[model samples]
Target chain A: MAVREGLLALLDEGPRYGYQLKTEFEAATGGVWPLNVGQVYTTLDRLERDGLVEVRGGAEGAQSQKTYAITTDGVAALGAWWEAVPSDDPPPRDELMLKVLMAIERGDDHALKVVTNQRTVLLSLLQAKRRERRVMSDDSFASKLVTDALILRAEADLRWLDSCEEQLQTRLRAGGTTRPTRKADR
Target chain B: MTAHTLPAPNHAAVEFFDVVKRYGSGSTEVRALNGVSLRIEPGEFVAIMGPSGCGKSTLLHLAGGMEDPSAGRVYVAGRDVADMDVTDRAALRRREVGYVFQRLNLLASLTALENVSLPLELEGVGVRQARAEAREALAAVGLDHHLDRFPDDFSGGQQQRIAIARSIVGRRGVLLADEPTGSLDTATSDAVIELLAELPVRHGTAVVLVTHEPRFASWADRVVFLRDGRVVDDTARTVARSGLGAVS
Candidate 1:
């Protein structure tokens, strides 16, 4: 998502055509950031409108190729955008939590079965991702980081699921028909 | 049992006992409803009139069991609605109460028939049976012709009629109208009120209408006036004093 601003900053180094910028951008980010030709052109047009970059006329005969250079305003805007841009901290969106809540509301043994099945599937997925991460090259730091984060989150989710199962068992023993009351409601 | 006499077991359709609703807390606390106790009889059509911020809607919501009374109980169809959980209360509303609001809140994407079938679908009724029942309800509202049309395609009165059809489709015993005729012109409002008045006698339903206009309230069997969340006055009459009676 930061590819557009990253490309703009790279263009600040010197005037370059779309393909040249694309290649340099890939090299800078270790190929983690990929851009289609269409995306590159679209970002360029947007940059030009924001007064961050200027599109100079191409060489006399080469009408298809146009060069772009970042303006002083563009450089300032990019710096501001970089400073203003908050770090990505993706929140947990546990579908398992939703499933458990609805299941408890339903107050049936079927919900417990669904939760058990889902946990098994999730554990298998976590193991496979871990195996894939082990074979990945040490140089692919971004790929390794993404995979490690996913595995850790999945493990935490499994722990939560286990606790939920224990809670469900306790509830089932007390009375199968009783509704799960929210703590705040009590 | 005499042929003319009905059973004594049939009690009032609505009862509120020492009901209190407070907003905020401590120094800022505002009591919207304060120990309000009242009963609405079965087969009677009543209108609640009040000024803004007088807890008219809140009272209606409590009577309909949409919200819980902070200190007291609300009973609908002789069942203690306050004792039920939120989900059960919602089910009670779906099965036993019909609500009509000033704004016809019909989904734009769904046709009139689809809108009417929603309550039944939510109640776990079969799709075919729900649709059949929805069709019957629409016909009762004289909207069978407009069943296939979307809410946006119909006029305001027509859309409101569709909303009414949706509310009554489940054959709910108690009809709660919250400013049902607020947005309509005089003629259309009269037409809607006429349809509403006829429903009780026709289907043996109880109606509780909330309105600001005395003219609109005139169509009710009794008018209960609320000022500062308390019933300031109520009519002694047993039927609507207006000229129109039992529409054919």
Candidate 2:
């Protein structure tokens, strides 16, 4: 959907050959997102079939040479796309959370161990990302931002692990079992 | 052999062997550190992370000879810290230990150069030689041009750089920072963390940083996690220059 919408938005500016669309899209994303010519043309073909774009010129040569222009409908769609915010209607499943829940189901000790083990792995990944961020030149802002997002996500996971540990400890101190126990019949 | 004559094996910058620290007495006694053993090789960067009251700062205090362990031994640059008398400990701190805190204790009135060179001057290094060394330290932190500027004249990040320069000014063997970036904004904190990361490579100083922020801790060559005065985990960075194994 991103590529489909992206190509539509690109065509809205002016007619562009397939190769030009690929280069401009890659450039617009600070060269961090790579789009091959075949994918670009495929997306363009879908847009054309959907009435979002039309073949303008260079139809006699290779697909890369074919110029595509956005239709009137495409302009309206791009405008709507700009105005629309990303939807999170369906909450996404996170693997770490799932792991913690499963571990809790197994019992408190297992959960604590899981959190500690995950912290080790997450810290290793965070260190790698930070090291990569260090080597990046200042001019690569897009690359740095991408790396920053990954780092922040890992940190958040770590904080959650800490919280999990604290909660597990509190339950243990209270002499509570993770699972409910059966009462004896009177 | 006597503790004084025995060097820390393998040239450790700082080493703790079964260290235990307690506060108060008897029923009221709280173990601030419970049998911790760790080592920092020369020029290695290690970060300590944990919940509050987990003894992260206590570990650093012992490393810099600020406090003696209740049991076991602590060594700084191969000297037994517990064996050293008060004056020798003070001398050890002056010559081998440096500390930075969440709040940089930079004197506001002094210029950057004066603040950095003050430690050297206190140790009886001549004013001229101390100032030259301070200049080099400032240059290392990329603040050479602003040597004469007072702390107030610089931005927060620049001020932190000045504080860092002071910590490493005398070529101290160990640099201990307790949440050095706790007061800075994200961008400024990143810059400060980057500067701290450079200390080991640039000066071969063994650096110990205590921080709750994983982002900052990631910059260290190893991360030690403490819980209730015990090390729960110790992880070395995968791409560490020394390839030291985890201590856990």
Candidate 3:
């Protein structure tokens, strides 16, 4: 999501300065994403221009710290973003899927090797994530959510690879023909 | 000149001797297995892949002494299961073979620690010793903190791990997992597969798994494919390409 929307959401809580918004954003995301102070200010400036936020006050002088609050428009924008499920009209390009496709298209004995190599890499990644998830405490709820999602996605990918391998072997058994190509999957 | 042929190395952990298993009789007779003979060495992992009725489960049942062959002898850990009494067979299974059933079958009332340790305690291991082994098994499958939780409280994936922990509690020489990851999500399945792959070296256990998924077969040292109650394709090779072999 854009930092613009993020800043709006943070301001929706109440008036907060740029530094505080940056810190809260990182905290909300389990500190996995680091945000820059300059980037926060830049996004906040855009939000103000769009009339989604306004500065609260200049405490002492023109150079005094200023907090920003979300306007009605900002709240509306945040609500819309919350309810909207992001589009998946076009599937994301997956490198492993692409590699398997290329290997199959080339029509050599290399398909098994390619699939095996990719599967090995993914399995190792999955094992590490599982290990991490195992160590997660109840306090690290955000991190736990992130790791849980990761572990599920990794597993889905592995199942997809398993299906691909099964199909490939079946084709080989049926007198060596390439499978009908379909669009890449998650 | 007399030439010496090197004596064959004996490494079979479970050997099937022309085993045949048929159900029903006469016109309705269903031959679930047809003279299937195979061998699994200690510290080696093998997989059985086949269609639903190709007798993969039958083979595993025979290997674990849960079923007797209709026409042949079944040997596990160097003893003929056909010759053993009920108690002897149960004892053999307790000490040598670990079966990871498809249903998980975790005792609902027991805690994860208790469930995993139950098998060891039944085998007459001291309570303290069995609990310690249970702790290590659960930890091996990454369930350290969940030792106190019951199966009802765990996620499907976590419960599966608990099942695995229960299976490996005694460090059994042979592990027979029937569709071990069939109920798991892909990512969680990967973790289970990694653990199965490590069993040979981690606990000195031989694994004979039955999976429809070919990718899981990749983790195994051998793959035996069955069709129409007969062995169609069985291949054995080193697992260096799996990378698990090279990893510490």
The recovered share of true contacts, given per candidate in order, is 0.00, 0.51, 0.00
Alpha-carbon error at A137 in model 3, in Å? 1.3
Error of 1 at B177 (Å): 1.2
Give Cα-based local distance difference scores for all models: 0.76, 0.85, 0.79
Q: Per-residue CA lDDT of candidate 2, range B49-99, in tens?
A: 887788999999999999989998998999889779998988888789988
Order by TM-score, highest first: 2, 3, 1
Candidate 2, pairs of clashing residues: none
Better of 2 and 3 by TM-score: 2
Candidate 2 achieves a global lDDT of 0.85
**Any residue pairs clashing in model 1, and if so which?**
A52-A74
Tens-place lDDT digits, model 3, residues B51-165: 6777999999999999899998888887788988999889877878888976899999999999999999998999999999999989878889958888999988889889988
Tens-digit lDDT string for candidate 3 (A1-186):
567887788888899977889999888778777898888877887888999998888645342287889999999999999998868845877787788888987653467556655655565556456657767889988888888787778768867766676676667767886554645521
Per-candidate DockQ values are 0.00, 0.38, 0.04
> Which residue pairs overlap in candidate 3's backbone?
A155-B186, A155-B187
Give a tens-digit lDDT track for model 1, residues B1-248: 57674424766788888899988899998888887888887777777765566678898898888888888888888788866888888888898898999988899999999999999998999999999999988988888786888899998888888998888887887889999988899889978987787678787678889876545565666666565667644553212232223221
Cα error, candidate 1, residue B93 (Å): 1.7
TM-score to native of every candidate shown: 0.52, 0.84, 0.56
Candidate 3: stretches off by over 4 Å: A59-64, A178-186, B1-95, B103-172, B180-248
Best of the candidates, TM-score: 2
Question: What CAPRI class is candidate 1?
Answer: incorrect
